[model samples]
Target: MLHPCVVVSGVLLSLAVPTIISMESCEFSGMPGMPGIPGLPGRDGRDGEKGEKGQPGRLWQDKPQKGDQGEPGVMGPSGKRGVVGKPGPKGARGHQGLPGEPGEASHTDATQQSAFSVARGTATMPGRSSLIRFTNVITDFNKDYNTETGHFRCRVQGTYYFVYHASAEEKLCVVLKLENTIVASFCDHVQNHNSRQVSSGGLSVYVRRDQEVWLETGDYRGMTGKPEGYSIFSGFLINAH
Candidate 1:
């Protein structure tokens, strides 16, 4: 039973020298065939040591059915700066926005002044109520009127305009106060006939902050002899409510 060891086309061609095919009356032996010429295809071995890492690829749902989305894969060489990924989850508070449409009216803040004062030389208010001491400052501009305390301080709160003038050799009267409250008056008369009297008056006022305006002479002794500023007092700041 050993002569069948040299099988040719079934790929085992070795051991060709032992020929004893008999086990007590069951077969005949050896030597009578002639078709032996086809043996040349045997040299491609040695690539078999990489089989231990094949089990980690079957975990995407044991996947074998998803085979059509694979044509976008040739751009993969820019991946080395990936460590800053922990701050992205706080964004939801935006909806109270609809009240913005009223802008264009701003006035008053350059010190807020437009003032005036006079009486630079010849003055005479010598009979009792005397505060008409505007030594001369034709426009105090935010100095708020303090010509040696003739007084007009109302640093800014609204509508003001004041004016005054007086001259009388025989009679005169003047009044214009805003803190003690008399707001405006002036008078001149020639009852006895020296006849060069003049008087003036002006007032348009709402004035609030600090509040103190002036000009007082009422019994009237004004001669106004030289008459440069002409015994006058003036004021301004007409709109700052």
Candidate 2:
């Protein structure tokens, strides 16, 4: 029988594989392989034309555009005056009143006596004597004795006043009374022959309708004079008030 020899294959089985080989060690290395060739740039594509605008939408046609803001509006005008109202009617008249009755009489006391008759005396009170009493009637005109009691009664409610004058050739004395009480007394024992005039104060007294005020004579025995003219104790009975 003859000896048989077989061969072994070392192929790199790849579609795009770089060929390589196994080698024994070398003393020096060879130069590196050349670089790959540069490739050409690709061409740019053309731009397409714009399409026609679509038909106006409903919102685009209907919506209002904002207008330029208008100038600030002019100020408002003033209002007109109102009409005057009508006047009211007049008021009614008032009713009449009834009349009043008369008043009663008035009584008075010592205050209203006359000026000349206030003092007691033997001589006359010149003009104011409604009633008078003389102690001794020596002469009609002689200053012999003016017997003023220096007092009188208040017959009515009014004012009264009393005064007196008295004289003698030598001795002189006067005594006056108010409400029967002695108010004043005077005497001039010396011969100068005093001629004195005295009067009561004008007093305001309110005596009821019919009250009494009395006056009396003194111890000197002088004449008791009446009240002055218009000097009644109760003459104020009229409704003069």
* Global lDDT scores for all candidate models: 0.71, 0.37
Q: Give model 2's clash tally.
A: 40
Query: For candidate 2, lDDT tens digit of each residue in 53-168?
Result: 99966665566778988889889988888788787788788688677787786775443332222322234432222233434332222121224442233334444333334332
TM-score for all models, in order of appearance: 0.25, 0.24
Query: RMSD to native for every prediction?
Result: 21.9, 21.1
Residues 1-241, candidate 1, lDDT per residue (tens digit)?
4355444533432332222233553675889899999999999998988666655555466547776776777887897897888999999999999999999999846876666666635554455577667676766776888877778888788998887765665666778888888877777766765456667788798989988888777776564635543666787887888
Q: Estimate the TM-score for candidate 2.
A: 0.24
lDDT, residue 180, candidate 2: 38
lDDT of 1 at 109: 65
